[model samples]
Target: MAPVVHGFDWPDRFVVGTIGDPGERTFYLQAKAGREVVSVALEKQQSAQLAAGIDHILDELRAQDGNPYHVPADMPEELRDDEPLDGPVLEQFRVGTMTLGWDPSTSQIVIEAMPITTIDDEDEDGLDEEPEPDELLVVRIPVGSARAFALRTREVVAAGRPLCPLCGSPMSPDRPHECRLPDDQP
Candidate 1:
């Protein structure tokens, strides 16, 4: 299929949000430009990783410029928790590859989400294989928006199952997680 590119050079809003209860949440990367909106489904990890990439890039930029970088206090507090995915939506492809970058020249946050691949690692010729052509969603938003995305993603991720104090694994909300505490830790 032809790649469905939503290359928003500077979208009004590009953010990651989720739907569903805590344990069953579904993540989405939505890009809105005026009235044109494109929403794609992705794993929660993908959203978290993209936000981390944005944070890392912003940190480097601030360090180099010796300027304080911050997410606007007015940024959305919640990621529209449990909002139904925007759709009449004929299609909802799973995301396989997610790329994030900060365009130094434009100072804009760039995000790319490629559809989940079904290709096998080895080819008939025993060479590495790549996924066939597929739709790619690309979005670019301001630095402040990007910063807010990261901060809010972190917060949302933390709101899920609590972590085990000993092993740091996620503890079931209704039950305790079996922790392999270190010998030193009583």
Candidate 2:
């Protein structure tokens, strides 16, 4: 199937938010222009990666002059219109491969998200047909807005359950975290 592309040249609002409680939360990366909104579901690692990439790029750009970034304007250069998690919630599908890059001509951060596929056995049905390509969600956001998005994304992704001191895995919500230690250890 052809990609269901949601391309936004300059979105009015874009953010990453989560629904549900701390232990059973669902994270969503949403971009909106007027009333049109495109939502994509992604793994927590994806969220962390995206944020880190944006931050790394920003740092690289600033390190050229070895000074903190500062822009002067009557109004803020970046769009501070952060959409709350509970505001205008929309349906989102799981994402598979996600790509992030910069467009020099437009000076926009490009993010592409492809749909995730489920693993299944087709031998039972005796059909050997290959699966169709998944659709993608493409978002082109300005550098300023991209920075804001990165900040918010880091917050949301880190808001999950705390990690275990010994194991490094997220602590179980219901039971005490059991460290994955060696068999010889007590």
**TM-score per candidate, chains pooled:** 0.77, 0.76
Q: Which portions of model 2 show Cα errors greater than 4 Å?
A: 64-82, 86-88, 118-134, 180-186
Estimate the overall C-alpha local distance difference test score of candidate 1: 0.70
lDDT of 1 by residue, 1-186 (tens): 677676787776666666777777777777778878787887777777877788887777666644544434344544333343456433346778888776766777788888887756555663465656468888877777777767767776777777677787777776656778789876
lDDT score for candidate 2 against the true structure: 0.74
TM-score of 2: 0.76
Candidate achieving the largest lDDT: 2
Residues 51-150, model 2: lDDT tens digits: 8887776666556564434311112434554457546676667878788887767767788887776546745553565344356788888667777788
Error of 1 at 10 (Å): 1.8
Clashing pairs in 1: none
The pairs that clash in candidate 2 are none
Q: What is the lDDT of residue 87 in candidate 2?
A: 62
